[model samples]
Target: MSDVEIICDKSFSDVDSEILDRFVEFQQAIIDKDEAKLDEILTEKYELVHMSGKRQTKQEFISEIMDGTLNYYKSEIIDPTILWDDKERATLVADVALTAKVYGINGKWTLDTTVDFEKVDGKWYFTKWDN
Candidate 1:
């Protein structure tokens, strides 16, 4: 028999206020290029569908952001709407823009975006990002 190990990468659970609060914090993290700060908000098991067409684990996502490989000089979330399905999961829709930047990219498409998130232990984490 072969020993099999499974890695858990489940989406976040359903929660509301915490989820939105974390979303705000996530925006801050992006601006600060903080890795550990972002990781602290995630569950041991998490998933990220990046806007740049990549799927990565929680660590991968934070590392890339903090490493300057994927730089986000200026960004903002406007007209945000949060939907909570439970105490561990929710979704958000918002309009964003880039106020400034250096070498990395800034600004999303002119259109709006929808992001789904999950909450655990009163912390919000992004589970999905789709345009």
Candidate 2:
């Protein structure tokens, strides 16, 4: 019955904004079905774990998108919380509503997801995502 308290570093705002921007760009890439844009957003070692517990490498995920096995219609991110462990690494957790088709099955889903990012060469790239 007590109120909960949430705290994060104040200096994270700028970095969090940049990371959030990248996340939005990532979602847009899916909606646009732009493989090149996706490639640009993900790190070379990127991996994704779907809500169904399916795991994919960066190339596999991109291929699925390119071949229409996975199609994204919309994505809405809500209440994203970002934590920076250091200058080079951070984690973002968010509630997301997604409208999509996976392997020909169409559905809308709401999921709590986490994405890990790493800063390399002055840019943030997604390294891992789990939903």
**Prediction RMSDs, each to the true structure:** 12.2, 7.0
Give candidate 1 regions above 4 Å deviation. 1-18, 99-111
Q: Which lDDT tens digits does candidate 1 get at residues 1-131?
A: 21111122333344433555576676676667777777776555666664555677777767777666666545555666676677566777766554434236554433265777765554566766554
lDDT of 2: 0.85
lDDT of 2 by residue, 1-131 (tens): 21111233344478788988788888888888888999999988999999989999999999999999999888877778888889999999987888889888899888788999999999999999999
Taken over the whole model, the C-alpha lDDT of each candidate is: 0.59, 0.85
Q: What TM-score fits each model?
A: 0.66, 0.89
Worst 10 residues of 1 by lDDT: 1-10
- How close to the true structure is residue 20 of candidate 1, measured as C-alpha lDDT? 51
lDDT of 1 at 73: 48
Best by TM-score: 2
